[model samples]
Target chain A: MTTLSLGAARAGVELRSFWRERDAVVFTFALPAVLLTLLGSLFSGVYEGSTVTSAQYLVPSMIAAGVASTTFVNLGIGIATDRDNGTLKRLRGLPMPPLAYLMGKVLLVLAVTFAEVLLLLAIGMVLFDLPLPASAARWLTLGWVFALGVVACSLMGVAASALPRSARSAAAVLNLPYVVLGFISGIYYTPIGALPDWVIQLGSVFPLKWMAQGFRSAFLPDTVLPQEVVPSWEHGRTALVLAAWCIGGLVLCLMTFGRRSRQTS
Target chain B: MTDHAVRVRGLRKSYRDTVAVDGLDLDIAVGEVRALLGPNGAGKTTTVEILEGHRSRDGGSVSVLGVDPARGGSSWRREIGIVLQATDDAGELTVAEMIRHVARYFPRPRGLDETLSLVGLESKRDSRIRRLSGGQRRRLDVALGIVGRPRLLFLDEPTTGFDPEARRQFWSTVRALDTTVLLTTHYLDEAEALADQVTVIAGGRVVAEGAPDTLGSRDVATVSWRDGREQTDDPAAVVARLTAAYGGPVPGLSVTRPSLEDVYLDLIGVPR
Candidate 1:
């Protein structure tokens, strides 16, 4: 119980530190909003024959993509820097439980991801004239997707931190997944139908695809999109798959991060 | 009367193919400031880390405050404090905020104002941690270690980069704490100034352990005058003889015992 409280306090401190940097806030939230606006306005080709606007289709995916990038790249780089500076080793020597330290990091990821999602959604609604979901059920689905995306991406960030020996290398490793997934998950473009079958299958195994799909369900009406072999917005299956990825990611993160800490110490 | 704050029997540790701590034994009583002096890679840091429960030993029986640190839980950790060599500088929080945040983890902790005053940073309580000077930052590290009012504290080369004035101020702070302090340093003067007992480790083994005044147990003393000098086991008798010859106190005469550094250098077999 004390561990949990300590973790929450430390997480608050971490969040405050991150929010103090004006450039980081801009990079985390504003860039995604700006990109969503630019791409939504210029890319009407996305829904030429459909009834949905480009903003309606692209904003949700961008929101998902923004969450993923913040969790993986931002967190991965931050932890690596802490390691390089001996901050992690110092914390290990304290009386606090190991879980407290990890919980703090996880909470930091959650706070940042939430801020990013809200900012993107606000921009989409106010500036791009995108409509909110019509019912509480649809909004609930969106919430589940956002929550699962945070867990999966934060765990992936912890896993990626182990791949690089230094902070710079960790940033490089993190950027790879962020850039590739942004394209493969159709954040900047609508390629769900055009992507190769195997590529889509592999993407389905990850949370990004489900997150995008769930967001689309909330923002877009079913009548406008083309009929596919299987509908993208099956709420039950999307939640199940994203939940599974989150669990798998948690296991991988615990194993990899604990092992790395011991080895380095 | 003999309850040791720390007791170790045959401590040994290895890193893959290389051994770090090798069959080391030590016992330090409560309230004793024991200084572990050695060159780099002499296993000082490794041994300290193991004692702090941050590293595991291959073999050892280490009882710190009546419990083995290797298996000690959070309760045991509450009794000990460790000042690491470096800290995270990313946070924009002020020193006061940082201390308050860490204080929540301990069962009982010193007040924030007392801690700030103890570290001589009362004026900088509102200053951001990142804006502090190097000496001020190190003081913050010390402040954090003592804020919990730990029964035993480990300081690793605490004053390595400090200027003379800053180092003196740090020594005063350590003196004021009056807790059991186990420090490791390459500076002999620091040991002589602060340590009640000194232990020198060389090549992963204890070379000597005793008070700073009589470390080497060398009986010989040097008697010097304006003209010449002589070595003798009895410096007082020689001083009396010299005074008689000069028909008064011998001019510029002095009897000198070996300095702790000289004895230490001789024991470690390093050419001065």
Candidate 2:
């Protein structure tokens, strides 16, 4: 069989293992949507001079965070667990190309992230009355942003997997930055304009901030534009930043992966 | 071109300041089951890992299946299967499912049913791997290892955690595989039971390499009679003389050669 086909088979196995862990599957799929519902209901007001409720504003922000959760956080913890449990070592010894193992993981994340995004969108539409993109241009923007965001975040996730010393500590190691990034990136607290300038600058240095901004542009209207930290959605810069992260993250992943002897064999 | 399944000379590896494998040499012919016997930290694992291509040796000329492991690519990897010690991954996958998942990596793989029976996991084919007992799980490990029908298999202390019964069962599973195997273990009886040739290493070097029974001194044998015991090269002659002197079967007469364990202890410089 071809290497790519082996990767596809590996993805099938990954998906099976992931889904069979019933609690993790439910929790992973439910966390962002649950938070959206609770936070959406708790923060009950429209932004000043705009009809878009705070809940509606949160929908897109949460979607971006949702993407990160599925790709970055999920992949990071999964890879670390694999490393700890001897999955990586076993795969390393196999005829499977190292690329195939990576491809399988990325494919798993892609599948899960799509499902996560759709779930969040469904909740936003039904519960918060958020509108889907009505324009082909908005849809196009959404596509590229989602694509680039997944690629960049997934690569970063693979790189980050090498940070945690073991599977037991992987959750804490990967999630701390994820939660902190959400706050500073305005996913947890929005109308990005409300945050301090330094916070905005710091948040902008990361991909989550740009991803949340891109999604906000796709979901929110021109009326909410001034509420953003920037007056307009910096589409070009968003693309540039996410693309740059993709390259940088790829390099980091290459540097860190296949390294020997962190865990006792 | 060589028919040896593995060949190594001066294989060395160190962890920072600690030398793990220092100038180790190994040779195993095709279809031979060679056991590497050593104490902990004697570089057995380091040597095996280097040969498996999972580790890089600091210095060595190593070839596995006619390819240098450090440079071994996917095709080279296909010819070898590895069962690592204490692998706890893929718990959520079922016995058959896990085997099938790995089988796809090889260009040609054993049939699912055939592989399952080979490792004696057919009864647990649909059971989750996590639910398997230790012995059964180990069988599954072997199932995954040999599913590709590799020409060479590396079993790194394959029966380390097994109970006596489980170890016996696992030995049979391994014995069923018609492939060259390089196993690492500290168990003398396990080495004697499974290995066609045993190589004992200490301090990262081969201390002795030969058939298990004759590893240390093939010439010496011990003869014990009711009246006396003596160590001599000609035990048959000693036994005959004792029987003739007694004018019947010599009372309490027993002839013994050095056991593999005795030889192993002597080889490793452990007094008994």
Best candidate per DockQ, number?
Answer: 2
Q: List lDDT for all candidates, in order.
A: 0.82, 0.88
User: Model 1, B101: alpha-carbon shift in Å?
Assistant: 0.9
| Model 1 TM-score (2 dp) | 0.91
Query: Number of backbone collisions per candidate, in order?
Result: 0, 0
TM-score per prediction, in order, is: 0.91, 0.93
Residue A183, candidate 2: how far off, in angstroms?
A: 1.5
User: Residue A97: error of model 1 in Å?
Assistant: 2.1
Candidate 1 deviant stretches above 4 angstroms: A22-24, A191-205, A227-241, B218-220, B224-230, B233-236, B243-257
- Predict model 1's lDDT versus the native: 0.82
Per-residue C-alpha lDDT of model 2 across residues B1-272, encoded as one tens digit per residue: 48899999999899999999889888899999999998888889888888988778889899999999989998898888999888889999988889888888888899999998887877899999999998898888888889899999988888877899999989998898899999998788999899999999899999999887778885589999778899998988998888789988899989889888878788888887
Prediction 2 global C-alpha lDDT: 0.88
- Compute DockQ for each candidate against the true complex: 0.61, 0.72
The CAPRI class of candidate 2 is: medium
